[model samples]
Structures are given as structure tokens and as C-alpha cells.
Target: MVKKQNIPAKEKIVSVVLLAGLILFMAIVIGPGFSEPSSPNQNVAEQMLPAGWSAVGGWEIYPKGRLYEKINGREPLFDQYGVVRLRYASVSKGTNDFEVYFYDMQTPDGALGIYLANTPSEFDELELGTLADISGGQVRVLKGRTYLEIFSLAEQTPKDFLIDLSSALVETIPTEKEARRTAVELLPKQGRVRGTLILNRENTYGLAKLTDIFSASYQQDNDEFDYMIRTISPSEGRKMIAAVGEEIFEFDGEIIQSETNSLVAEFMGKTLILNQTGDFLIGLYGAVPPDQGRRRLDQWIETMKDQLHGSGK
Candidate 1:
């Protein structure tokens, strides 16, 4: 025997609606992990193939979690720059092969961050993407929100091929015109050495816990010096000072305490004049004396202030 209860049409509709809502919520919470990563539609392979070259296969996509499978030991560097996804493809021309890697780094700055961290043995600038350079056997580019790399698998890597491929890749990626001006605008430009500016995402100047630092070299009075700037929360700055207090003292040099939380010290022939103002840390490194270093640091701060005030930024 079976017993059945007749449900009202409105009740059935409400029940179905409730179930649909639940499913939607679950999808919102857990769907992304299972779904395919949303990689940019870059139809690059067809253009990359030369007359005799053949693509090995379709593009291979690697999300952050699976990036390690492709890069292995270098995953952390990509992770540091907020890499979204990686689209990779390979092609072979007889015995000559080439690999193209497109890393979606989330933002232009994120792309540049990774680029700055890479200290290449030599730099040959290329006028492709936002910033591009050829180093060793690779051509690296930072354009839009992407960090693209093309590696040469053959002994004879033609510079013309690299240039053409880089130009093509740059055309595919989007760029923000306004973002072209970066924090470099905040820095005083006078006497700055071209091609000497760089960003260190972490552990700047071999100081542990010092991160997101921008530095440049300036030529003054027949001498060159490094000026560094970093924005940090007051609490984090204090914590860094506390964490590195012992290490700072361990330097085999004269330590001159000029002001509270500010020091002019000589370490390994370099004079370091570090000053903390609110949420900003500024330092100048040179062979100058403590008094000269302090005066120079103050002048730089004033110059920065004037620049900002003039720009109304």
C-alpha cells in the first residue's frame, strides 16, 4: 500500500525556487575551484608559426594552484606578483623549437614587480609592450596585466624573430594609458642616473622583512649614491625596526644616532642615512660623512615635498 499527499501548485513552485537558490549559492561559493580558469583569448599560435614550424598542440592553461607543475621551483615569484593564470604553447621549426609563456599578473604594476625582481646579467631594451628586454636566451615583456616570456630553444635565435613576436604579442594585450606614470613620479628626478632605477618587492638591500622598496642612484659631487623609499604602515615599520635591531647593530661600522628611530651608519664602506617620517621610510647610501648624509637626506625630503606640492598630487 502507498499513501500520496497532493501538493498545491504554488507550494511546488516555491519549493523549486528555494532549491534553485540553494544551488546558486553553493555554486557561488565552490564553483570557481572546479571551473576552468578564465584565461585571456590570445590567438598567438597561428601567428607564431613560420613556414616550416609546426605547433606541438593547443595552448596549455595553468592556474595558480597548478603553476608549480610547469615552473616548479619558481612558483613563489609568480605568486608574489598576483599571477592569475598562465597560458603556454610550444612550436618546433625542424630542430629549432620555441616556447611562449603568457602570465596574467592581474595588474600592470604586478607585471612590472616581477620584472624588477629579475636581475639579468645583461639588458638589451626592446620597444615592445610596456617594458621589454632581451637577456640571455629569453625575451621578457611586461605589458598591461601580463608578463610574457619567449625562450629560444635553438642555438641561433634571431633578433628579428623575437622583435616580430614581441610586437605581435603586445598588440594582443590591452594597456591603460593613465597607468603609464607610476611611483617614479614621486621620486626627485634631478641628478638621477638613467637605467639605474629599480624596484625590489622583498628583502631590499639584504635587509630581511624590508619589502616593496623603490631605489635609484644619483650622481652628486663626483660621487654616486643610492636613494631608497618605501611606504609602510606605522606599526609594520616599528615591527621591522624591532625585528632588525640586532642585525643593524651587527654591522661592523660606526653607528651615529641622529634622531629617534633615525640612524647614520657606515657599513662595509657605505654610509646609510635612514629616516622615518610618518608612514614613509627614506634612506640615502653613500660614502659621505654622518653630518653630510643627514643634510643630504633633509634636502632630498624637501625636494620631494616641493615636487608633490607643485604637481598638486
Candidate 2:
């Protein structure tokens, strides 16, 4: 038998330290990790638009909780049922004063859709959706892919409306080669009169009179024709160039040189320029008889429209 004794203070201290270390090691090995919280807008967007339909750059959420996206740096708009409608303030000037819509329609080939002038025009009957162009600046999704169309209550004549509308119509929709041929027959023959029409999936078109045609070193030292247009998709500057060789001829041309999901095409003297990215088609038409050119452009646009509808780009 031995007498029991109280533990020394030094021994008690060492035992407590060892027990604490064991507990710390177990916590570190088994505990869960921490993470940061997500933003409110991102959370809302994830819940809204269909999967993969994310907000592109330059999009903002308004105080009312609505999301607005800008088009070509001019208007702030919202999308509803695949239709883009823009509301203009009273202070806005010119044909800049309207609402615009973008949508798809069912066609014989598939779906024919585009941007349209929804205003009080004689062509409204040709529109595929409900007319929503109440304001002078409003546009409705009509028959063709209208990249851009402006409206103005200040104009004394329908000339401005017609010019914009015709340009938009001609750029996105395909023309009948026969109709263009007939139209060409009516023009007065002269030096090579050249015009080009371009369409992109972003619902935009560029119509230009090609005068100064030249070649320059483009994208990674390739030589291609340089031309001009009245207007183009503002975002197209950075999109990728698609086709480089001429469609009907071997003439060299370059498509968009930047990072773009859009398509581009150019035509010079009956030569066709075709560039495509994703489901968008870009076409260029050069010098041809007036009627013939118009018809051909229209027919081509029709074909492209069909392609876009079928592909849903």
C-alpha cells in the first residue's frame, strides 16, 4: 500500500497544454470553410432570364429594379418576350424620338423576324407583331430584320422616315433578284455606281456608297479592301472577321477585325463579301444594275433571314 499525493502545479500545467493542442488539431481538420456572399443583381439575373441569357457588358439595373441595356450607345432599353422596346424622353430630338421593337415571326421556311418601324406608316400592315409605335420615335418589329430605324415628328415630309425605313428594310431583308433586275433596268447608266448592304445578328445594318476602294494590310498582315458605310454596329469594331475572300470573285476583303459574335459581308462591283460569326450573316453587294442589285440584295437578305430564323441566332 502507498500513500496518495496531490498532483504538482507544474504537472497540471503540462497536461492542460497537451489537451488544448489536441482539441485545436481536431477543429482544423474537421471544420467547414467560409465563403463570401454574392451580389444582389447577379442573384436576381440568375433567377430571371433563361439560363445562359446573361447580361452583357454595359448593362445596369434601374432603381425600379428593371434592367436596361444600351444599343449603339444611344438608347437604354428593356427586353420583353424577345421584343426590345425603348422609351424616349420628351427632350430627345429628331427621329431619335421613337420606340423600337425586335422579335421573330413564322415564315414558310421557318421564322422571319426583325426590327421594324411601328409608327403610323403605310407599311404597318406588313408588320408581323402587334404595332407598339405610339410615339413618333417608336419602332415595331415588322417584316424584316431592321438593324436601325429612326423616327421624327419634326419632319414636314415622310422623306426622312422613308429613307431610314428603306435603308433598314433593304439591309436586313432579302431582295428578289428578279425585282432588283427590273429596278436596275430603270436606272440611268453611268460610271460604276456602287452600293453595299451589311447585316449582323445584333439586328443592325450598314448601307454605304463605295467610292474610295483601296487595299491595306489588315489583321495579321493580310491585304484586303477598305471601304466605308454610313453606319455600322458600334460594338462590331471589336468582333472577329469572318470570310476574307470575295463571294463571287477572288477579290480580297476582310470581315470585322475585332472580337465580335456578329457577321459581316462586303461586295464590290458585283463581288460578294460574306463574313459570319455564330448564327448571324453578313453580306456585301457591289456594283450591279440598279434593279438587279436591289433584287439580288433583297433575295440574299431573304435567304439570310431564313437562315437566322431557322438557326434562332
Candidate 3:
């Protein structure tokens, strides 16, 4: 009692093709999300062992809790750097043992934060990435989001072995050399202590909101003192000046009023001066007198201004 309708052969064929295309599109776009998420880097354990050594033990992951235990209770320092994870393993060949630690920082800057804070001595620079320093039978490399430290379990292990292992790891971990300049570059190369540029990431010198500070040691008359600069926006510069003002009062230190915002304070037998110039908060720490500190600070500020102008900042 019902009239029957049939699709044309060509129309049926077109519908089938369209349905097939839609399914294919969904498969391509939505299928991968259904699978497990991939790891950050290629399996580090596989690339760790070199030609002459074997992994002494299985790879271990140290999340927040275990990470605190592994670094000799320096958790606060690592935390400030925004560490996401730590991966470690040991390798041995014959009697020589090597320990490798990979700190998976949240970002390149975070990795740089820890590297600068550690006060490493410079030995040989590597082509692996932005910064690498080899010292005391160990190698520290900062590449992208990873900070790697390879050291001998016993200082008896050969340095060449550490270098070889590090080279392998560097080739495996996916990272390109950092191309951007950093605030530390503003410091004049002359008279800056080698490998002493440190980025203090938080609460620098017990002053609240005093952070992102880059400091380096300078030598005059063979006396070592530290000079530091914190880069802030021109708007935030006023806030820093106010914070330093309040801090000076809290510490019972005298504030040296000047046309250029600066203050003189004595803390623990060392004279400290905080200066604000444009978008920078500058500080000098050590036994330098106020006049000498001001002179040195002015020179640094001028040098930074010259560098900034040259770079079009």
C-alpha cells in the first residue's frame, strides 16, 4: 500500500564516497587523541649508555617528593626554578661509575635559572646548546627545557668517559641552541667574573618582589664584590623603588636620597646599595663605600644604556 522510492545509482555512489571522506577526516583528526599521550622527549634511557658502558640500574623518576631527597636537601633552590621532573640513572663499565641527572625544567629560562644559581666553574664550552660548563670531573649543559648534569660517581672516573656520555645524550635529546639574548648579556664583559653571572629567580636578598635578578662578581684590588641588576618594566620600576624604600626602613638602614633613585644600606657587615634606573633595579653588595659603589654603579648603568641603544632596546 506504500509507494517505493529508490536512489539513483550515481546518487548512491556519491553518498557513499562522501560518507567515506567524512570518516577518513575524522580518523585523521580525532583518532590520535584517543591514544595515549606521548612523552616529552625520546626515551632518555635508550640513548644514555655509550659504547663502553652499561646502565648500572633502571631509570628512575623523581617527582616532587623524591627530588627533594636526591639533591642533598636543596629542594628550595630547585623549586624556585620551576622544576617539573627529574630523571636519573647510573652507568658503569668495569670499576668506573658515572651518574647522570636530567632536570626537566618547565622552560628554558627555568633551566637557566638553576644553572646560574649553582655557581659552576667553566672548563670547556660545548656546541650542544645555549650554555655548557665542564668542571670538577662533571659536565653541566643547559639545552632548551632540560638541564643535564653528568658526573663521576667517584672522581676516579675518566673525564673523557663523562664527555662521551654527555655527547651521546646531547645528540639524542631534541633541542636547538637558544638564539635570544638574555638580561645577563647587558653586563659588560670586562671585569665580570668568569662563569659568575647568576640569575636569582625569587626573593633576592630577602626583599619581597625582588626577583629575576642577574648578578655577577667583580674584582677591584683583588677584592671580590657582587653587582646585580633586575630588569622590570618601566611601570614596575616605581614599585621596586617603593618596595626597596619600605625594606630599607624595615632594616633600619639609611636611604640616600638622590636625583637617581638609590639607597645605601648595611646588612651583615656589607654595604648594599639599590638603584633604580629606567626599567632596571640595580644593587651592589659587599664592603665598597657609598661613593665607590655609586661610581661603579653609574659606570655599569652607562654601559648597559650603551648596549641597550646599540641593540635598539
Candidate 4:
């Protein structure tokens, strides 16, 4: 029998401490009892609606369970936005008919995401509640926990009628206590394309692991590319960086720059960069000529840092 070698006492103590820390970390990440509350089943469709407009018919409420059955093909999109409830109404004012749809999303951000996804390019920004966008025949608004979509069936429906209805509804809904400026606001406006910012609530850039990401189009030297960013807890940010590192390595990507807090990789005929700073994971994707990408990222970092710090966020 061979003699057994004993581990050093100090080394054993260190190992024990590390193992305990690992257990605690895992517990915090995956432990039970931290689940979010289920959406309420109540329907408030007719609660605060204005009474002046004659109801062409009664309102229909689709609770969380029935939303899929009601919306059919578009159920997946509503689910992606964390929809809790939906209300629909059909009314007529003289010769004009209107179809009013009210969506009860889980949060303001969720409502905003749905609003962005549904609105068209010609919608004009309206000064109502958190944000409101109106087109010639449609009006969409994002308030505290709801998104309102009012569609005018007749071409003759006056824009004033749409504005009045939107205003009335906004006044009834609760608004956010304080408006939170989003990370998208920090993007440099110099080379950015207008109306190109997209807030993805799910499956951002086909990366299922990454959700609630914001992407925008940018132009440099007539070359168009997209960049994305998502704000998460510092711990989660670091974990995401580690996961992405593995993915890039598997794709045979070269790491051009690696540091304690930042990583830059070149892959698939393009350059991609990832950085974490104070609970934010910022990235530049599809940039050519590594140097240009780096410069753009540096500029974005500087601007975001200044803006966020100055705002005391």
C-alpha cells in the first residue's frame, strides 16, 4: 500500500471557505421563494371609461388565461410583453366607428415595449402621460401599467377626437412617480439613425438568454451597423460576460482585448465588444475594423458614464 499524502492545514481551510462561498452564491442565484406574483384575474375594462361616447356594443375583457384564445396568432407577442389583461370596445360617433383596445401590461417598461412594437413610422409624439404616439387614424399611449391602442375605423374620424379620447384615458390611469431615463437615451446622436431604436423584450438578436435589450442603428463612413445595451445587476453582468466569452470561443473568435472589466472579440467577419461598468453590460455589435468599433464603444462609455453620473442614477 502506498503512503497517503495529507493536504496542508492552511490549504484545507482555504478550500473549505471557498466551497462555503460557492454554496452561498448558488443559493442566492437559484433559491426558491423569490418568484414574482401572478397577474390578477380581475377585469377593470369598464371601470374608468368615459361615458359621453355612446357604446356601439358592450366591452369584452380577456383575462390572462383567455388572452391567447382571444388574440389567436398575436398571442405570443402579447405574452412576450408580459400582458396581464386586455379590453376591447367598439363605439360609433356619428358616421365614424372606433375600435378601442386597452392592454394591461405588467409594468411601464413592458407597456412601452408593446407600444414600440405595434406603432407605425408615421405616428407623431403626443404630450400625454409617460409617452404617447398618435397617427392620423390611430393613437397609442404608454402609461404606468397599461398601453392604449385606439383605432379609427372610418377615415373621416377627426384627429381631435382621437386626441380627446387619449387624453381622457391617460388622465384616468396612474402615472409613474418618477420617469426613468433609459440607457437608449445615452446613445450618441451624431451618427445615429432617427426612429431606429428598438427595445426588445424577448429574443434580442436571436440570443434567447439576453432579454430586455435595446438596439439602435448607427452609420459611420456610410457603413451601417447596430449596437445593443442592457442594464443588469453587476453580478449578473459578470456572469453574462463569462457566458458570452464561452460562446465566442466556441465560434473560433479571437479575443483582441481582455481585461479585468472589459472584453473585445473579433468574430464572423465583424468586431464585437462587451464591457461592464456599474450594473450595465454595454456592447457594440457588427462593427468593422476593430479600431473603429473600439473608438465608438469608448465614446459611448464616456457619454453614458457622464450622463448617468450627472443624473445621480
**Alpha-carbon local distance difference test for all models:** 0.71, 0.31, 0.71, 0.72
lDDT of 4 by residue, 1-313 (tens): 9999999999999999999999999889866433332323324444445556644546766867566545678878888888988877776666777887779998766777787788696867888866688888888887777888888988767888888877877777776564545565455667877678789766555444456777888997856777777757666777777776667777687888876557787767777777777756788877577788888788778866743332112
- In model 4, which residue pairs have backbone atoms overlapping below 3 Å? none
Report the poorest 10 consecutive residues by lDDT, candidate 3. Answer: 304-313
lDDT of 4 at 39: 29
75-179, model 1: which lDDT tens digit per residue? Answer: 898898899988887866656577888899876667777877764768788878666889766888877778888888877887777666667666767666653
Candidate 3, residues 1-313: lDDT per residue as tens digits? 8989998999999999999999999898877434432233334565666676766556767775457546767878888888987887777778878788889887666787888777454576665656777777788887777888888878566767777778887765665464434455556667777777788766666766667788888887755678887656554655666776677678776666533356676655667777766556677887777778777878777766633322112
Question: TM-score for model 3?
Answer: 0.59
Candidate 3 local distance difference test against the native = 0.71
Question: lDDT: which is higher, 1 or 4?
Answer: 4
Please provide TM-scores, in order, for all candidate models, with all chains considered together: 0.60, 0.19, 0.59, 0.67
| TM-score order of candidates, top first | 4, 1, 3, 2
At residue 190, give the lDDT of candidate 1: 78
User: Per-residue CA lDDT of candidate 2, range 233-271, in tens?
Assistant: 323321323222222124343332223433333433333
In angstroms, the error of model 3 at 124 is 10
Clashes of each: 0, 32, 0, 0
